[model samples]
Target: MTRHMPISETQDAPPRRRITLPLAPPLEQRRLQLYIALLLLDGAAILNGFCIASWLYLGRFLDETSLLHSQVMLPIYWSIALSLQVYTLTALRRPNFARARAGLSLIGAETVLLFVGFATKSTDNFSRVSSLLGLGLSLVLLMWVRALVRPLIKARCGDAVTNTLLIDDGGTPLRIPHAYHIDAREHHLAPDLSDPHMMDRLGLYMMNMDRVMVSCPHDRRAAWALVFKSANVSGEIVDPEVNMLGVLGARRERGYGALIVASGPLGLRARAVKRLLDLALAGGAVLALGPVLLLVAVLIKLEDGGPVLFIQKRTGRGNRFFPIFKFRSMRVERLDSTGSRSASKDDDRITRIGRFIRSTSIDELPQLFNVLRGEMSIVGPRPHAIGSLAGEKLFWEVDHRYWLRHSLKPGLTGLAQVRGLRGATDTETDLANRLQADLEYLDGWTIWRDLKIIVNTARVLVHDRAF
Candidate 1:
């Protein structure tokens, strides 16, 4: 809700400079501690709610058979809890009004329970009164859990105040009661715009801040926002003339000041929905493709008697490394894990079956496992190997902004791939164009777009670049 914004934007800046901000340890630790405490209490509440509901559900017959059912339902219930984000929703930093909305969240839990019960065929087995009673108890216990944890959260974090950075141009300062405001217009905080040393110090100072408010002119807000978001901080333009109705989020509230998420492709709820869909679809695909997978394995093994699966480390979400699996296409000796060079159309290292599999994209079937493991997505930007290059330079070296593509998980097929940007990016322009499409995908990410990309990828399987 309360995001950071850059305070200053040197309008007539001579050159762009990079700023490195170190994270604040004390604040980060306190935040993590509160989150852990909230999670533990939520677990406790769910357990207590389950016990109370079991008593009413089973009535006079509390036997071991019912216990088995309960065991079966435990994970489902846990997942229901997670999907509703019960723990996170009840965070004490949120106002009491927000905390009270836990009841509304239960609606989501109830909806999940209905589908899960039907999927597991427990709807017939479980009593109606029991289910209703249990859900009611959960609602109560969730509130009680927050009530118990609220003091602990407040005691450690101290009234939910933010370390705010205010960049006003010697005008009226923000009068936010809970914010520890640091006005950047002062020389001590934000020094000469051209000084590299000052920039480094400013970066470090901003890390200690929770929010950055730039008191700039209305039209310049967009430019200031980019600068702040580039630094991976929440950016707000403190413009009195700018109307929030149009620019701010539809769900934006009348808080102390206007704040919106910066650099996010989608809202929190949308991301959750996307993640759930990925898990469900990826799981189903793995199950349905079992026979095809086995046949591919056999074909790969019979070709050269080497490893049937190719396991290579590739860049993943947040630039993290994860092993990607594919039906081994090339011979063991010729595998290019680093992606140092592009695979030529008639590369000799590729086996006969490998060529067929790669052409048909059967080689990429193993990546459903990565999707299942949550390291990759059903659709997004395609991750390259760490040593992947656009001609002479590494992909990242071609454009420093390329790292932004890693914000979301790498996909089995991506926006770029569907748009015909797959295969080797042989030039800087090639890589830049792919990055542009990838960034656009990130900016306007939606579940439907993922589905379309997947469909498009399927259509392009027999293309010339598949080799």
Candidate 2:
């Protein structure tokens, strides 16, 4: 969590002036509100169209039969409209598309109403001439309302449908129309992964943006790609060869091109479900294991009169640092908080009680609190300590994809742990095996898969490599 100098600034240089650029509000965030507004406006248009038709053709503004027809037609039209994408972002952006969809929905609704009326043997519900006039007027009104709102929508949401941020990170120069651009040198913005505060600074610039495109040098592309993945944002790198590689996707606009690198794995609903599962399981485990936790705390405290819990900073979601809790399995004097030293069998650092807890994997039970705090999940890639290494190389040095695993919250137990990939990573091959499992877990996540992983974790609690 160390704070460093701004991305481009040095200690000897004078403070850089912060510049604020014009930014459009994120349209994606306000889409729900716009949809509701469009729905209400369409409803009003339908009701007024029917009333005018009733007055001109039926000699009454709001006859009971006409009112009933409008009521019956509204819900049917709405359902049809939703199915036709009449109330979506595309509808808002294209007036012609919106009008055509609205018209189609109206026809579908009228056809459904007539069929239902005939089925019920009540075909005389209203005059055919009046109904025909009402349909024609409603169609006109729908098209008028849709056309009228196009200019207003443009004024509000800008020319681009999604909010975009362009970062000029000492790479090729490019411009995205209607996108907010910031000079990395002027803003003092750098993607320093080791510094949580710097990541936070970069995150602020990306706030409310649907996509972030970085124009950085070739050397920095990997670093920026990792940053984007860890942040779980839709990210793109400016490169013409991107389309040739057939990566995620490519965006070519005007004379500039970019390659999409990262996108969020879970949607809003999926995230909500996952979070609820974590809260329910973590909360229940705390209460059910209350006695065991208490006994362990007492034993750890009495063993050497040391702290009951061992807290060490581990890399969590978004490549941020979070303190993970364990039941103080190592002696106070011998504890390796930085995790530079890996535990091994017959290690003298473990106390008598620590030996029992570490062997049984009871030392890890305290991490339920991390799950409750939303820092960890019941099943995911295990968080690695900042200084953890495989053989002589650091974990990230062994595999750059290590950062991608942090895109999701670290877990109490992971696919690696259940597959017997736990304990000391003695070599690069050991770390690579675990990293492969972690990456595989990310490909097609499902609630059922997570449940299966949790079930599998129970059988390996007392693993051979745990100590």
Candidate 3:
């Protein structure tokens, strides 16, 4: 029995047995506890598996001469297990227990073990037979532990999951255990396929949910697919004909149905790593470019004596507004607040230094501050000013798909920018083309993708179209 903490002992039991109250913690806290417990359990299993394997092959625990050797090996095993990302595979995102994940993770563990065996000359300490058996046993225990725990987690967090559609006009019993059945006729949060605000709310709701069963127009399938998978939510639907996957590059994430899908990609620790990288890179850029930025600031002040930074509101994730920073490369007095006019080549409103910065894409440098502020990613869809236009029409008026770009934080530079789609939307075709690139970035996002964009962006920095 897995005993959840935030519990207290009761004095009614005899001898050694004591009763504990079901003092359930907050949802997020409980989820964190579950993750920590899983890591600890896997770590312990690795140690135990090694002990058993050692005895089987060498007739002693770790075949070590001293307990000190075992203690040193204990931390090493834990370190190796963590570095292999063994816990990550357990952060499932599909509808089933992915026993395959354990096998894949074991392969990774085995490879890492082989590297360590050679590096540390572990073959000289323990026989090859012991090493292989120990690894096999550890992974076996990992899979076995997950097989037992996944069901319990599903049952416990079941309201956050829906195996069957609970949407109804009225009076339908939700068949799935702990499913949050909605009387669609009266439920304010019921998904409205046509309303963008409603879709946003539903997407927000999905951040707390795992598998969600929804019914909407067939044409709107792509929108829901972007919303659900971007949020990492998955589910089963009775209507087999309603599939919107691969349209905008959304793929069905199998093996996560039984597990909770927290918002975004790459699990908790992976996200932390990405976040750390963002801060490091952004912070480093600010420091590395300090002299260039100061020079630009002086030049801007010398020309107009206005704000060095052109702080403007741009749409961020979930259509939330955040201030994006740029070096003011335009005459402050002539800046277009409505986004009605797009900058063109050799615009008179841009001063000499402005022309240089704007052309060199140096004006976008201050967005590193936005990245450091957590208002933007180092790479993603570039944040467009509100009321940004495509020809004579506002971007949102161009298509509903335009709004889907807000699914992630806007970036300093993006797939569209690096791919020569930067500066001026002169036609609906241009706007549509950029939207496609943005969708591509969102659906196929990775740290590597970000790095590639960053590298590619340098080549186009002085392009003619930028101004």
The prediction achieving the highest lDDT against the true structure is 2
Q: Write the per-residue lDDT of candidate 1 for residues 1-467, one digit (tens) a residue.
A: 12233434466654544333332323545665665676566555555565577776675335343344445545564565555554452344674643455566555656766787789886786666765676677668877777776676667666653355666644445566565445455335433323323433454555545566665555555544544543334556664433444555522324434545354455556767888988998899989999999998998898789999888877665344679988999998998887787777998989999999988888988899898888888887887777788889887667756666755778888878877777777789889989999888878677887888877887887778888
Report lDDT (CA) for all predictions. 0.66, 0.84, 0.64
Tens digit of per-residue lDDT, candidate 3, span 166-263: 44333223344555544344435543434445654454444344446544445544545554544344533323221433322222332221212224
Native-structure RMSD, model 3 = 10.6
lDDT preference between candidates 1 and 3, better one: 1
Better of 1 and 2 by TM-score: 2
lDDT of 3 at 218: 50
Candidate 2 has an lDDT of 0.84
Tell me the TM-score of each prediction against the true structure.
Answer: 0.55, 0.73, 0.61
Error of 1 at 319 (Å): 1.8
Instruction: Give me the displacement of residue 147 in model 1, in angstroms.
Output: 3.3
Residues 1-467, model 2: lDDT tens digits: 23333434567756764444223455764665677778998888888888889999878998888888988999999999999999876887677888999999999999999999999988787888888888889889988888777777777776676788999988888877878877787777787765556765676566567789999989888889888887767888898666566555677665677887898677655777888999999999999999999999999999889999999988777666789999998889899988988899989999999999999999999999999987899988999887788999888878777778877889998899899998998899999999999988888889889999989988999888989
